[model samples]
Target chain A: MNSSLITTKTQRHKEKHYEVSAPSVTQWWSWFKDHHEDTKSTKKNDMSSDGNNFRSALVIGYGNTLRGDDAAGVRVAEELARRHPALRCLSVHQLTPELAHDIAEVDRVFFVDADAMADHVYAESVEQTPARSVRSHSLSPTSLLSLARDLYGHAPRQAHVIGIPAREFDLSEDLSPAARTGVAEAVECVGAMLERS
Target chain B: MTKTITISPVTRIEGHAKITIALQPNGDVAETRFHVNEFRGFEKFTEGRLMWEMPGITSRICGICPASHLVTSAKAGDDILAVEVPETAEKLRRMLTLAQWLQSHALSFFHLSSPDFLLGFDSDPATRNVFGLIGHDKELALKGIRLRKFGQEVIEILGGRKIHTPWTVPGGVRDPLTAENRDRMLAWIPEARQTVGIALETIKKVHAKYKNEITEFGNFRSLFVGLVSKDGALEYYDGFLRIMDGNGNTIADKLDPKKFEEYFGEAVESWSWLKFPYFKQFGYPDGMYRVGPLARVNICDFIETPEAEEERKVFKKLSGNVGVVNNSFYYHYARCIEMLFAVEKIEQLLNDPAILGTTIRSQASINRTEGVGFCEAPRGVLFHRYKVNKDGVIQQANLIIATAQNNIAMNRTVHQIAAHFIDGKKGKITEGMLNRVEAGIRCYDPCLSCSTHALGQMPLHVELFDANGSLLDSVTRS
Candidate 1:
């Protein structure tokens, strides 16, 4: 397959770099500034906040968009943006240490990923489980929380793994039938969870 | 009876590999071999794909250094289209390459090798890792992680993703650097530079303590090969191939990448699936040479960056300013110097106005039936050659991976260390000895994923056998 011909959401997103004059540019600029500026440190104890204080949530949707059905996480993340536009969402290939600082300041974190082993979509609470040793490229949600705790002295107050059951992993752009259904379920589940939060 | 002691799947490396040391009946090391045991036919799968897909597809070869493959394959695409990459694209490519160097070298030093030095080689394996380094010194460990994060962040900003970024195409990159992203990248340089400075100083102090390791580990005389600028300075993105002798003599210079077949040859060995690449002039094992940080430092005339330039001087003075430093243990020191240079280079590129230019690609059609591209990967020099049909469909592909290029040198180094540390006596086969043997290979930081290009996981298992071929003991790390 001509992978170059297969334009991914990432490629399309990058192509948007040239269209900076678009109407949404100002909105994106604001979002970028608010999310990125002065985010280098998040050392405040997220769990120590008063029960009545507002809690900020970080929603990370990670998957390879090029692989069939593997893009479910990214799809759910994109859908979450539409359903809950005010939420902080990051679309990535995987969880990395750089996200630790971001995770540290947030009171809640939702890690959305595609799981081939899962028979159905599900959401479960995830606890900090720091790796004995770390590979910079291979951090998981638990590891990122652990890293936040280790480096920043605190992790998010609550973290949940939102898993979308995936059936196909081959090199293709189309999601599987079950995965398409799973994406909707994941989006609804995440939307409900965000509402309850 | 001769006894064999094996250390399987040297831990904390990018991929799996093992080392076997044979002990003679009289309690002296007899032989040693470095084994790569996995096969992923990446080349075979590439046959019939559109040539433009290579940069994207081949980037999957190794997660650690996928940027290297992506950049190198794109260069090959450049050759096929016969179009000069725009100045902005070149700058971006250089910046990306350096970022990769920064992250990859940091990994080798802090995560893989530092634990052995800081925690002591004889320390418990469980604690002798990056975590141990963190427990022993939190600031240093955190600095290492942040330094790596800086590189990965730069990559993500430029390519839109960390691993398997399809941003790099045949003629140029997919997107140009925005002024915002440029400033964003520039913002990270000061801290990145400071971290590398800290690491360099720490390694120098650590190096001073490892007198025996420096003297005995993988110290041998062989040739060195790497890319050098026209003026014989350090060049990683693009340069002429230069070869230097182990004792610091220039053997050959300005060998064209297109003409590599004339001076490079690959020899297949029955025991290892990885091809043993050697200098054609010297032939087989005799032409064996080392690459990666050690070879880059050895073969380069000078580092252009200021801090690294000064570090180079110290390195030269320490090693008599010779053309090559035969000791592989110095690879750690060389890695630090390169990381410093990469950080400096990144800052330089980010400041360049052309980096903000939007004209990153040069549109072109198929202009050549075959093309070859070569670049210095984080591990060493990597070459990718492709033959395409008139319609741009790849007919055949050949990848000369860096680790395979260092196979002969790694095997010889394994033998050298095995002989230095091993004896037939039971006590000689201590964990420290095993570590030193593994340390010899670690000097190369061999990425078996890139070398073997294999499917499935390959865990390390070291086996000890008597002359009669009976298993005496084995240690397997999964």
Candidate 2:
């Protein structure tokens, strides 16, 4: 909304995008380019190549791995890493306020969680809300986005929650068949989104 | 007829609890109770698990201080194996514990209790929180955030993630300290030291203004308990148990934690899920003792670092150097000093040459069927005990958390505050009176989750009971 930067507003848009000429954005873009170049040179001698150049994205996958099928989010994150080697992914037990710092550095974020109440893999766009002080062990993804915007001075340009339906959350290590199927669908959906970007 | 008042699910603390105040026929306060509403059968659930999995499993008891559980469980495992952990691993664990102390204490002092001191107790309840503190002093609020972040950052560097990192294991830790982590932690020391220094100074100055409140707010004589080094210096990671009388006399020194059952007794009441732990020497209610920062400061002969040592001297002077401080409100001061000591200790550990050694773990099999582990958790001294079969599967488990240990003392403090603040004949309680009652419990920073861990969104409820044991009035907060 600042007058110094170019902005666009649209009516039929389910997604919001901004074109920025801010010096900070320019600096971050150059830094990412340099980092990508360094990564390419470092892996120059590797035999097998992961060809996809991941765009600026932050994927946060959180769930208790100790609880069966609840690890679906982490599993999808692992799958995404294999398919898009350069993507930034964080696997956590829960989302904490500290992650707001990381969220500020990216242009896009995806919060993946196992939804026991869901029927199938689902994805929804997350818009930042006014940040409020939370008095709990963890914060919701939207709350984290709000925190990043209010406290850290920058929020991700886009964010979404990729929910994978989970069938079991008992004391077992292996995922349920339903959760496995859901993870596959989730992987395809999230992977396609990244590819299109 | 007598009447009772209830304050349900005390807010701004970890976990859920309610306070019940009973009044006599003449409208005089008779009894006050702090009831823990949730309980998790952790001991029963861990019965069939392998002893080695305890460090990870038990760490889930409380998300706020999982490192304490992890370290204590690992130590219990050490006792089972009967093997001494390597020196480097011990140093690394010490660093981890100190980091936990920093974060936990910061949360208690700055986020939880600071509002009571900063914003007057009579301030609007809606605004009496960390956000309120932010409105009053943005710099201080930001400083607290960064301070907590620094502590969590250290934990992340040591283990892998901040919460519930399975870095520590039996006989030692699984990872060695790296030069990068060491340097990063050291760089944070100066700023941390500055922030705590300012906090200490601010607390001391403000404490003088609340003299009347301090004297009347849960200020009573009770036994104090904590861990102390061999020379009776403050020790958090490993030390001998030291118990002191209200007047600064030693009740017991160098008590072995394995023999804790002999000196400590846990009593349960029908009204609450939390156990009331008391010193065995006096029996039941008479042996009630306070723990956490107040107990640690009172039990220690001296602090290690010069800066904290100076604060200790000031603290003692305030308490008339009687070797014990009876006032519960001084918890804020003691917490600040301990945080200073923790930072200093962290800096010292990081500079130790052996800290970065690769010899982090020692391997050993179960040598004992029964074992005990003890450490001074951020709240107070915590004990983990387990009895295992020959195959290394746990047969029984017992955990004495810091909050549970201070349960009796917390209850007594509530009674004391209610007696002083609540005027039964007035037939009405002011919001400030309720705030005072809640403040008394906050002094201990009781984590109901650590004491009686549970899940479910239970709305906070407070019910009043008459002398005939019937409900008179009730209040619920969501």
Candidate of highest TM-score: 2
The numbered model that scores best in lDDT is: 2
Query: What residue pairs clash in candidate 1, if any at all?
Result: B9-B460, B27-B424, B39-B454, B40-B453, B40-B454
> Deviation in angstroms for B189 in model 2?
1.3
Write one digit per residue (lDDT tens) for candidate 1, span B20-55.
777787668888878776665678878999999999
Question: What lDDT does candidate 2 reach at residue B130?
Answer: 60
Candidate 2's C-alpha lDDT?
0.77
Where does candidate 2 stray beyond 4 Å? A1-97, A106-133, A136-150, A156-197, B25-27, B162-165, B423-431, B450-458, B461-478
- DockQ for each candidate? 0.10, 0.11
The DockQ-derived docking category for candidate 2 is incorrect
Candidate 2 local lDDT, A161-184, one digit each (tens): 777778776555578998898777
Measured on C-alpha atoms, candidate 1 has an lDDT of 0.77
Q: Which residue runs does candidate 1 get wrong by more than 4 Å?
A: A1-131, A134-145, A157-197, B427-430, B450-462, B467-471, B474-478
DockQ of model 1, rounded to 2 decimals:
0.10
Q: lDDT per residue, candidate 2, B1-478, as tens digits?
A: 5678888878766776888888888777888889887775678878999999999888866767888988999999999999999999999998888898898888777767787789889887666766577678756766776787788888889887635657999999998877987898899999999989878977987787887789877788899988999998999989898999988899799987778889989998999988999998899999999889999988899999888998888888867756678988888889999999999989988889999999989899889999898888888999999999988899999999998988988888889889888877665656678889998888888876533111123355666666676665555543
